[model samples]
Target: MLSGQSFMMFVVLLCTCAFAFLNGFRDASNSIAVAVRNRALTPTYAVLVAAFFTFVGTMASTSFGVYLVSAVELGVPDGIPGLALLLSGLLAGGAWGLFCWWRGLPISSTHALIAALAGASGASALLGNDGVHDAWRMLAGGVLLPLLFTPLFAFAASWVLVIPVTWLVRHSTASDVNGVSRAGQAVAACAVALGNGLQDGQRTGAMLTLALVTAGAAQPGAIMLGPQLLGAGCLAAGVLFGGWRIAHTLAYRLVNIDPLRGMVAQTVSAAMLFFGAMLIHLPISTTQAVTSSIVGAGTNQRFESVTWQQVNKVLRNWLATPLVCALLGGILYLAMHPLVS
Candidate 1:
């Protein structure tokens, strides 16, 4: 016998977990694409390593959860309406993720989620006396800016980092360089998985927490272990099971990645993502970061070596996904508002 609020909250929590699972499934390539492409690790082992590190990262910290909760609150005030907004956003994001995964496109689930949330918040505001302008402003300032800039930073950073690494290793024997690169690839893969788990897991955790608070099932400050574990576990399973399609696109279609290039690209992307998520408190897209870093790393060999067509497709998807999800989110929120309100 659950109360109406409690039932709705439970639904929202479930949706949040589902969204996280999709995030893991779609972005698993972000962590292991280079390693797989370079044959540094077998696909099975690479996924296992990614899953293990993802779980570890999720359990390691709650800081990202806190930041995401605060950001959502800033855009959509907490209550029943806020819960509705969150649910709408999660649905929109998840739908877009599934579509992209099916199409073997490595779009950013992070951008989808952020854009959906913004759209839902705008719709929620519309139902009330407050206009949608403030919500849009908050989203633009807090989430959109970081999402837009972090990939560029990762691209530039990876390009710069690869040049020096290339010079340093130029004199080494091919065998020696290969050995070092294989080892580095493993390490960088772990870091990327860990960073993804922390950033994405925390987002799901924050959504669950918000739902609980809205339902009066928990206080604002109370952190629940159950939701955290559920989110992390689901994400790990998603990584294990549903990553192959996007993995192929990323590993084979983007660029011909050698062990050295893979190592450099993964290392740069992981470092940038960790810095953005932990220090800058931004929910940057690991997918976009890694993709851009791959481009940067490929540029070291020659611009012609990179598949510009595939890169163009990815870039187009990245720009379109958010806008499409935002529109869908707004429509869903508007439709659900009367019932929820």
Candidate 2:
């Protein structure tokens, strides 16, 4: 017979896996959409490459996981209540991700996860004398700031990079330009995939680690390789199985993706993500970065070709994701509090 703590730990691991899968499923397009859209790689080949790189990138670093666990202080009670809180947050985040995937909306899973955790923490705090001040502070500094700024930075950076590059290569023959762009797209896609793996992979790993600590299976400072591998593998599987609908939305609906534009946007997005992960130590959204870069590139080359309607819809989804997931997480925590308490 399993101990009660063991059972709760099992549930937490399952929820973590599910959350990782949904994260990969919904965000896979961020790494591959440009390459597929530009015909630099077939859809099947792009997915495989993206999966492989995602795995490699995830295994390469655990810094983001460390930051998430240390920085975000959720004031939930430890043990069973903590497990319940984690499960609730994961469920809320995963639900929002699946909903967005179904609707072909490329919203930020990062934001959903952060907001869900915030909501659950807030709810837990409410049950005691403490308010959600720490949760709010962490949410604003660790999550919201990055979410707000990175996309705008990517947008401006992509526009600046594309305009000059386009002008410099304006005199090149069409075939030459196409060939160079295809090569660039391939390389940039791989970079984006790697970045996604590192940032998102660490996030899921951190969640699993937190759960393990709560269950007494691991210490707070310890990050087990098994859970990290499991998270990475599940993420790759999600990339392989899901992502077409959101890919289409990102690749075709928001802006026309030519080989040159695709390469530039992908490269810029990957660079921004890498900078954030390494230097800033922030877990920025690859989805937002990639999509905004694509839009920026399009706007620079041919402003009229960009579809503002689709862009607006995506923006709305981005804005709504955190709020919706927060509410869902709060409701779930409230419902589970009685049982867990």
Q: Each prediction's Cα lDDT score?
A: 0.79, 0.82
Q: Give me the candidate number with maximum lDDT.
A: 2
Best by TM-score: 2
lDDT of 2 by residue, 1-341 (tens): 99776898899899888888888887889988878878888888988999999888877757453345331354444578778877888899899888889889998787788788788887877787232337777678656787789879989998889878889899999889989999989999999999998888887777777788777777666467987788889888888875788998988899876788888999999998788788778878889999999998888864477989989998898888878988998899899878877
User: Candidate 2 regions off by >4 Å?
Assistant: 63-66, 69-76, 129-133
TM-score, candidate number 2 = 0.95
- Candidate 2 yields a Cα-based lDDT of 0.82
**Local lDDT at 193 for model 1:** 92
lDDT (tens digit, per residue) of candidate 1 on 1-341:
97667777878888988888888888788898888878788889988999999888877657553355443354345567767877888899899989988889988776787788778876766666332236566466545686688768877887788888989998999999999999999999999999888777776666677677766667766446877788789888888875788888888888876788889989988887688677877776788888888888877775466888988998888878868988889999999887876
Instruction: Supply the global lDDT for candidate 1.
Output: 0.79
